[model samples]
Target: MPRSDSRTRRSRTRSRRGVPLRKSLMVRLLATSVLIAVCSIAATAWLAATTTSHALRQEQGQVLARDAQVYDALLGYAATHRSWDAVAPDVASLAKRTGRRIVLTTPQRRTLADSAAADHAALPAAVSAVVNPLAVDSSLTGGTGATPIDPRAVGPYRLTAAERTALAASARSITGCLLKLGEPSQISYAPSGRPRVTTESLTAAAPVIPDVCGGQSRILTRPTPTEAAALHQLEGLVNPCLRRQGMSPIRIGLDYIGPQSIETLYAPMDAGRITEGCVEDGRREQLAPYVAPSALLFVTGVPGADTTGFALTGANAVRIVEVAALVLTVTVAAAVLMSTRLIRPLRTLTEAAQRPDQARNRVPVSTDDEIGSLAVAFNDLSARRERLEDQRKAMVRDVAHELRTPLSNIRGWLEAVEDGVAVADRPLTSRLLREALLLQHIIDDLRDVAADDAHTFRLHTERVRAAEVVEWVCAAHRDAARTARVALTWSAEGDPELTADALRLRQAVGNLLSNAVRHTPPGGSVEVRTSVRDRSVLIEVADTGSGISDEELPHVFDLFWRSEKSRSRLTGGSGLGLAIVRQLTEAHGGRVTVSSTLGAGSLFTLHLPSAAAPPLRRDPAGAAKDRRER
Candidate 1:
């Protein structure tokens, strides 16, 4: 019907039509479930593959470590022995410890020893390493840039039982002397039974050897007869090379410290290098006959074990795909069911909202979740709206009835005067003025109530004495009480003060006093009391009148409400006095309450916020009088 209504309807229609399937809650939920399922499957497959690959690498690494151990054991055996005659027991022990097949062969492929000979297992074509004492594997021996010859190949340098015992005793003596000098040292024997004095400081360039221990060093560092003979032979071989290089011949000792040569001072740095090369060559030649011949070392995995790398078979891959598909289907199905259950209640709410009769339309609350709570709250809001609609209708009727009565009286009096049937005398004029004033009062009360409803009611707040406000209102209404032959009185407990609108406070108190004076019988009394209670100033007006019933008490402050259902001005004054009092009290951030009993009186209380009282001023004359007494 209206342009805005047409536009709103069109907009709603467009929104409904424009919604796509992908944007739907159910579809999106299904998509999300599928995506999560896919990611989970992919992650699981990746983790499994990665973990398996790592385990395989670890297994390969362990196999390599065992192979190196076998190689090292065999190399040490060959280095010390002239032949492999006693190597069978050692080979079998290494194979048992390492869980591998160990086979040693000559360069001609003649099997020297085999741990798997009883099984008759053929040798692996590829060799693992070479067992050579003359040319050793430095990596296996943990050596860096040292001699290629294995240190175990001591040959003639090996000390006899007597020589070893003498060197050990000498080493113990040196260690004891070093400890007494506050320099701790330990005896460490080399492969040749040469006991050297080692300390924590020995790793440095200049080792600190105490002078007191010098005699012990001479005993320990002196080469034994067996080592002396070998060293003498090695020096003979090394001296020939030194002479060929034109460097002075140097004497060698067990410590390998040669005297500095003055003849080689002008030679290049290779002069020392040439001496080291000659020594290395001489030792290899001298020890060559004492060690076993070099041979190939063949180390294989556990007999009949799989040695190929890891691989995923075709069947396993198919199984993984099937499992992933199954997971996806179940996830999507569960998402569909869950989204449907969640959307069902929401659809019910939407349909209920779209209906024109909102008060009657209610969604069934079948759950205790947030959605069910929303339904309950919506039903409560609908009930409140219905009650307010009824109140609005009743308020319109009451306002009309209140305004029509005074208007009818004024019209009737004017029509009588114009028709020449009544005189416009002083008494008649006074009655007309009273009726007009009554009408104006009703209009003003309605305006104030409307202002409160619209939240525009304002109060100019100030600090006023509560006792004064109560006494002034009572004095203003005293004449009315006298005319009605009702006794009116006022009292105060203390000088209670209030932070409030003085005018509004008075108007509220006056309304209560006037109402009490009007309702009370001719001989009845109206009393006003002021006191402080709970940080609030209480101005209570209690009247000895025909009291309100319990049924009417709740609606006493309701606008356009009166105890007199007949709506007569004689019994009640426009049914708005108490309502205006409530509005004014609330504007000052205060509250008014009434308690009444049938056949007894009603007490109306205005509880306003209390203010601190001003300090009392001292009298100058009283101060002088007290001073003279002191």
Candidate 2:
């Protein structure tokens, strides 16, 4: 095998080993998408868990508050009623409001009122609380370090309507007096219909009592007629207990402000405690019959039943897993779609690039992305390669055709002279020398073209006049134009100067003039013109000849190209003149352009960089004569 082939085979083998999954674009994209999806799901789950925990805690607080409300309502109901006959409606209302099952039963477990009685549900094993007006649950009632008996259990102390109205008027009088004394106060009636004077800033330990309002307080704080009667009965019940405990009998009031009320009695601490105990016992005994019997209260369906804290249930767990799986699947599928779209164009480019015929192999451009731009650039490169290939083949044929005729003629003439069929005379020698010079001319042109192509063509640049170059080229072609019966003329707009090789400039313009004279018919005019334009000098050669066709105009300056493809070498010339003109013009950092129309004349323009003109010398005698004439 060839060394290059073996190396290529080894390289192909290495490439076929393939990339690892981690390095592949598709695999990386898939993994990245999955990672993003998992992160998103995890973040969403964390937020949901946090939010749900907060909401459940708030709900737990609401449940406890509602439970307290239910207990307070039932305690009030039992404090007023002697039985549970109308208590079923209240239980149902509490259950509906709190979204819980409330059940009330006697001490003997006999059902009193059950909100869920219609469903016949079994009661919970534990009781929430005990409902008793004589001994209330202070935790449920929000009372602390006070009597267990509910304050609402007034019983015989409940004020009559007539006494309540009379006491309300007294309460108003006290409130008005406090207001006049610059003390803002409001009137509040307790469950017993006894009005109390208080202010927003009032605390139980420190009551607001102005000097002028002290008498009003005394009047309002005094028991009403109905309360007085109840107080006398309560005192009668309490004094006996106090006497038995060796404590002095005390006058009982309708309300107890604080421990200060007991301090006023000058009673010892033990005596004060015993007095409070005795008062509670006597009050319970007095109000026992007017309230409901003690019952066992059962509340069910409260939130946060499992005391181990929050946890996701089986269904919720399954749903979360399903959602995570769906997200991952969707993300991976989308990644695959995007990666395929991205890699497909690259694959097409690879396949097209690998084809042997690059000039013909083209990839389709479907998107306006980077891949599309790459494909467009590749297509342009292919087109340029194709044009160069055509030009290469045509150059080979034209060179062969151009050299073959002269060689054949020279060979035939030498053979004839050697065979004694022709003389080696001056005319024949002249013909032979002309043919040899033509060959040398063609070789020289080819050498120049090769040097330019290799970037070895050097220019000895200097300031030269464009008009002088045009005149030289026109003068050289004047004899040929006259012999062909063609009129040659030359003109200049100004003495335009340019920085270039004078010899190369003459050669370029000479080529154009020669082409113009040869192509112009007899009595046709060939014109050479020079003018300065902007920072460049324009050398134009316009000829009234058989103009080039639109299709052939573009390739006029192409190597070895001729408008008359079938014309002989003698008639059409070597076809390298215009091409050399272009190469020489471009070597000078300039350009040559040709424009022609069918049946009309052709124009060739050389655009070269302009140079500053030298200063003109003034003639002293001519200046004196011109001044005298003025």
Which lDDT values do the candidates have, in the order given?
0.75, 0.75
Per-residue alpha-carbon lDDT of model 2 for 567-623, expressed as tens digits?
Answer: 476568898899889777776767788899877789999988788643222343443
* Error at 208, model 1, angstroms: 99
Compared with the true structure, the alpha-carbon lDDT of candidate 2 equals 0.75
TM-score for all models, in order of appearance? 0.51, 0.55
Runs in model 2 deviating more than 4 A are 1-309, 613-630
CA lDDT, candidate 1, residue 391: 71
Give the per-residue lDDT of model 1 (tens digit) for 1-630.
Answer: 557346444543444454455555556667777777777778678757765676678777778788878887887888789998889899999999998888888998899899998887877788778898878877665666446777678888888999889878877887787788787977666666666666665520112343466665666545689877887888888889889988787776654222211111121244477887787788878888988888888888767777665555565566667766766667778778877878899998888778846546666766544555566666645544555666778779998999999999999998999999889999889989988998998998888877666656766878789888887888888888999999999999989887877888888999899888888888999999999888878899998998899868877887677877998888788888887897777666667899997767999998777786332223434432322221
**Runs in model 1 with CA error above 4 Å?**
1-318, 420-423, 613-630
- How high is the lDDT of residue 45 in model 1? 82
TM-score of 2: 0.55
TM-score of 1: 0.51
